[model samples]
Target: MDLQQRINAFVQLGTFLREISSESISKTSSSKFHNQIPQILQAAQNNNRWFTETNIKFAFASWGHALTETTINSWLSSYSITQKIPNTIAIIMAGNIPLVGFHDFLSVLMSGNKVLAKLSSNDNILLPFLVSFLVEQHSDFKESIQLTEKKVTNFDAVIATGSDNTARYFEYYFGKYPHIIRKNRNSVAVLTGKETEEQLLSLSDDIFQYFGLGCRNVSKLFIPKEYDFHPFFEAMFNKKEYINNHKYINNYDYNKAVYLMSNIKLLDNEFLLLKQDSGYSSPISVVFYETYEDLSELQTKFSEDKDRIQAIVGNSGIAGEIPFGKAQQPTLWDYADGVDTMKFLVEL
Candidate 1:
């Protein structure tokens, strides 16, 4: 099928999802499109999957809804069609969260290449189920996509995602091919101290959505030294019902223990942890904070770590847009590591 046809297929998939009830998506019995998360989690524990079931659901929902056709088309249209499409793409999926490798998958397929997908054991459910739905909608997509349970080789190009450690392995193994090896990244927020109460409440979505497991989740905050964190804490407190889930409580308990044992000082309220740090990507529900003297200095610091940052949150007047609620729901132009993936694919 042509690229436009594929785009339409995706649009239909989104429509199909919207038509189904949340109960249907979460249901387990006799459903063609069921997410077999428990089984997938067990398999991942015994195999190569490195993420959790929660990660998978969040990634799929975020990308499926946020990355729309208009966005994809705009990116693709920016590239010159004189370049020939690559023939084969080996996509090494990241199990850090669910379906994190889907943008790579979409890029490869849309570029008219055959896709050899290495599923993260942690996310075995969503990708296969989504691909199945695509094939059910358009059988030709089956020819474009292939699932591999074995290690991959013999591809013209590669896109692999993993922690900073696994990135080296991907590089050494797939370096000969034209490849993009994505490493670890975290998101941060910069509070201008003039942010509205409305913005702070909106910012809470970026902090707590998906339990702060995705890379786009704001794990660090940049605020003026004199800025009082009380309003932010109060906002989070209002959303206490969100953390009433047993899973978040368990994470809070576990992380709280490690923090105390390690003698880390944290400003703890009822639901979140605000500690001091100069980095990004903290553990789930834990956020690091640092005071910046000026936006220029913060911008310079951000540029230095640009490769490791996925998105920047907060009310700072910066190049990246401020995302509210889930960090994973990035807009079309919200390239990972600031790379225009669709442009890369279209130019291939």
Candidate 2:
């Protein structure tokens, strides 16, 4: 199939998957879908068919809209597919959040490159299943993608994501090729105390999605010392339904203990903790904080750690927009760890 046809197929798949209820989506557990992900990854690797319908649908819906043909055409028109696309790309996926490697997958495919996906062990199921489903729908896609569990070689370009520690390793190992290596990032929110109840409530999603495991999940809150955290706490407590999971409770207990033992002062309200620290990105139940006298001061402080800050919440004068609950639901333009994958793919 031609590139446009492939893009159409992806959009169709996205629509189909989006129609499936959240309950249905959740029911298709990674375990049940594990075997299929390899096929999906294979399709993506083989035909330069990057996007699956499920991913497109999620992306569109995540952005609170439908993917239009115009949008697809516009995106495709930006690239010159007259030349043969790159044959292969090696992608070392990250498991920090569900479907986090999708943008890279889409970029490689759309730019007409075969993918060699080093699937993250933590998320071995979803991408493969989605790819398999697309391949089943379109035979041509089957030739384009491949999923391999083994170490890969001889790729024109590489994209890998990992913690700050592993980024160095990826850079050293893959630096010879055109690569984008991601390091740790933590999202934070700046609370001005003047926030409306609705705004504070909305911020809760930024704090708690995926139990705050995703890099985009806020692990820090910037608030003035006198800021009354009760309203924020009350808003989050109302959504205590989210904390029902055992994993979150365990993080809460562990972090809570560390705080107690260290004698770190905290402001607690039933389900979450607010503590002071210079760092960004904490565990599920805890958030680090720093009081700022003004936005200028906050900006200066943030500038010093720009590499570690992913998404900033609150009323800060920053460039990037913030999305709620879908901390992992990046748009087509959302570059991972702020690196441009599309540009990287196109360059190759």
| Local distance difference test scores for all models | 0.73, 0.70
Off by over 4 Å in 1: 21-61, 67-69, 81-86
Looking at model 2, which ten-residue stretch has the lowest summed lDDT?
A: 45-54
Please write out the lDDT profile of model 1 over residues 1-348, one tens digit for every residue: 777788788876665444332445556445555455446445544553334444444555556575467766775676553325447788888665556677788777766677999987666766786788889889998888988768986778888888899999988998888778888888888887787788888788788766677788788988897998888887777668756677677777788889989999988885788878766767776899999887888788888888878888865787665655546676666667777776666555
Cα RMSD to native, each candidate? 3.8, 6.2
The TM-score obtained by model 1 is 0.85
Total backbone collisions for each predicted model: 5, 18
Q: What is the TM-score of each candidate against the true structure?
A: 0.85, 0.84
Q: Where does model 2 exceed 4 Å of error? A: 22-71, 74-81, 321-328
* CA displacement after TM-score superposition, residue 289 of candidate 1 (Å): 0.2
State how far residue 324 of model 2 sits from its true place (Å): 5.5
lDDT of candidate 1 at residue 128, scale 0 to 100: 81
Q: Report the C-alpha lDDT of model 2 over 237-281, residue by residue, as the tens digit.
A: 866864555666777888889999999898887578888888776
Which candidate wins on TM-score? 1
